[model samples]
Target chain A: MTSTSSPSRKALSKIACNRLQKELVEWQVSPPAGFKHKVTDNLQRWVVEVVGAPGTLYASETYQLQVDFPEHYPMEAPQVIFLHPAPLHPHIYSNGHICLDILYDSWSPAMTVSSVCISILSMLSSSTVKQRPADNDRYVKNCRNGRSPKETRWWFHDDKV
Target chain B: MAAEEQEVRMEVEAVQAVYGDDCEIIHDFPPHLHVHITPRTADDSSQQFVEAILGILCDAQYPQKPPHVHIVDSKGLDENREKHLITTIENKAKELSSCLMLVALCEEAVELLSDMNHPEGNCPFCLYPLLVEDQSGTFAPFMKLMSCYHCFHSECIIRWWKWLQNEIIDSKQCDSTISTSAGNQREMEQQQQQNCPVCRKLFDAKDIEHILDYAGTNSSQPTDVIVEMDGDERKFLECESENNRRQQFESLLKLQQENSGLIEPRKEIVVVPGMYLPTTVMPTLAAIDAADEQHLDSGSTAPEAVDLNIPSNKATTSKHRDMNTRRKNRNHSSRRQPNVYPNRTQWIKKEAVSSDP
Candidate 1:
């Protein structure tokens, strides 16, 4: 109904547009100054400034996350990863495969970008004490050896950590 | 809750069950007990069946019944390589008993012929048991075994002959008859040691006689054979089994697909790289509040003990400076802050590096 594309393709495209638009709206709710999204080719990066309490670990930090969409877009999950100056959280592997349930295997078509960002924010806020995963090296090796990120199962139970 | 929210929650629960606290690791069985040998060799051309199975399990089509295990054709394998594949599979079956779901997708033609010729449950080419099942209910008992190059059931082969005699032929439904019949005739000729119509193998008639003798000895009670004359009935049963498998696969795929999308969206929040936040953060705020209440109740640790006009100061100057500062900061930050995207480059880079070998 939307375009010359097949029904499946059109549905997928509409879903992608809706998701991206929802994300943009959420940003609009409290649009941050000195932060914005940039798209170059097929890559989209969200730039952010670290503005919180002084002495907070994240204070004085500037971070960016790269989001890439497959040709299938929403029918397939977008590939989002922390792009520059990667953080070494137990859940955030060195390979950029975030052990976030919502972003990977647990994503729903209905989840807005706002909810995802909120989850990530809370994840950061509550992450008080945790170490890098013990088998971090092995996990990286496995990914390099052609294991899909979605296939690898990770355990991230400690919110306080 | 909305349907999407409910679905998301379900996905979280599923992932938690599979890879969360109290997860049970199912190890694979050992190989010596496997039912069949690999007809194909362990060459580069060999299908990586295990990887393929895992891939299928993770695919969007997963939990549709488990992907049928394929036995690659053995025409390319040497005897030793073929034996190696069979043994490897057998060893895998034994090792992955608890961890994996195993199923045997036997060819009906091979099974029928083997049933007639070999009484023991062993493959003629490599005497491995073709029967197999997994504990997880991943595999069904019966298989849609393709018979010969015909792609029809052996029973169907017989049924077709019966229908042809009855003169109720439906050529449209069974369009594959002509070529299959020709192929069978040629194969029969080859078995007779006549110049094989197709392969020209020139098999010895003595071998054919010996095989027939073996079939005669091993053939089970032919009286138990039951043929459903109605193609509709046959189609119903096939459809039932196939649909059951397809449904399971679809559910699994749906589960995986839903789970994949359930991940938290990427955020530019500061990641505390190479550092563990103090565990005291959770209990510290609560303990501080409790400590303040106790001090007020006990009338100790208050400047009132030093008689520094502490009681009056509570009403006069607010001694909650730190609390006020914290509260003020929280209030300022909690309100819609400017839409600043936290730099996530370091986090993403770390992820990339860690994912690399």
Candidate 2:
């Protein structure tokens, strides 16, 4: 448990504004063709649409991924949740704090907004198991008991799938 | 890690721009790099004016921090090149200012070399005017190569470099202590000399060397070397054998602790079965809790659940703590491993389920 110092309100605001500006600039650039993005500070919501899937479990679904940034912008990682109804995967649970090392313990300042989006896309594309984590109910219980989603420890050692 | 890596890369780029494929930036700089930049101020030369301006920027733009720049050459003290250098520096300063927030502490380095009066006192580490050299003639002249942000003697820097070099050598030797190839094992076997590199203490290296010899030699020596053998030669050999066995055991344990990440420090705990927190694991858990409580006290939002599974029974907890204390007392302490366990509720649930079944 590392000590996380709170960024000053002014610093937080400035950081948020900078990140927001960067995001806006990206949106204005060559937009992801057919996909749309929506952001709202009130809900602390960040949404992005994914287009063109074979309608398998996720086909034709305008999957909306949610991103929530903490006050300490770059210091802490964002909370990424899948808002759209989705099939369960062994790595993902009902509440969507991702199992990725990058989002939690291994986040690097070099990672930008676009890289995060690409990570999620890759996570979705590569998943093969059709279950909501190895121990689904235990994971949810841990979350409700105020444990971090990561503590449940879904071991994804097998990369074959 | 990334930020430090990037800073090194930027420094390399800066060097590359001037040297232009002629030099490679060496990574193994002495811990304290001493730099001295003396502007070539020739009379009425435009370059002198440029140098004056650059010097002013060095002083005013970045006060308190030593300038990371070192004058590579004092040749061609001409006017146009001086103006060009000033313009180059101004542009670089502007670009650096844009990254002021991330590079704040580093930028202070500019002010380090700017001060002329504080020559003898400049910190070789931070290049600050804090550290004054000992008047005793212990400081080396090579220390003037780069102003260390904190003043350190040239010999001190060289000593640090030597220590780092030796450490790398030791680590590499430790890694190759075991060899899969017969040829390499034979080479190591022949290289054995009974002595400790550190402390100049004597140790029985022959026994360890024998293990290296035995490992790939089809186990020619007896499975166990008996201590109470008849001859004095045999007794000495047995002692060496015992020492080698101990060395091998310690090395294996250290290697396991490094790779497993299960040991005392709570690096990342993904619950798994048959995982007893690595040896003497209780203190690391205690440290984690202390860390958490400190975080909360510092006013970061309280974490969702303390979620640490530090055992409750006073006897068992105390016993575990004692084990760690004893390990710390042991001479060869490599790293402290953390005691990580499944959350109490989950443990109870599993126990209940198993009991019912």
- Tell me the lDDT of candidate 2: 0.38
Docking class of 2: incorrect
Tell me the spans in candidate 2 whose CA falls farther than 4 Å from its real position.
A1-11, A32-35, A39-43, A52-57, A145-161, B1-357
> Best by DockQ, which number?
2
lDDT by residue for model 1 over B250-319, one digit each (tens)? 5665576588853432332222122212111122333334234322322322234423322334542353
The reply for model 1, stretches above 4 Å from the true place, is A1-12, A25-29, A32-35, A39-55, A70-76, A145-148, A159-161, B1-357
Error of 1 at B268 (Å): 47
lDDT accuracy of residue B182 in candidate 1: 43
> What is model 1's C-alpha RMSD?
38.6
lDDT of 2 by residue, B1-357 (tens): 456545545654554454343333333221122222333332222222111212221222232223333334332223444444445555555556524221232233223223221223433222223333345523222222211112223323322322323333344455654533443334322232222221223332222322212122111111111001224534653587755865776677778778984354232332122221111212233333332222222111212222233233235445446543333222133222111111111111110111111
| Winning model by lDDT | 2
Residue B35 displacement in candidate 2 (angstroms): 34
Q: What is the alpha-carbon lDDT for the whole of candidate 1? A: 0.35
What is candidate 1's CAPRI-style docking category based on DockQ? Answer: incorrect
Q: Ten residues in a row with the worst lDDT in model 1 chain B?
A: B219-228
DockQ of each: 0.01, 0.04
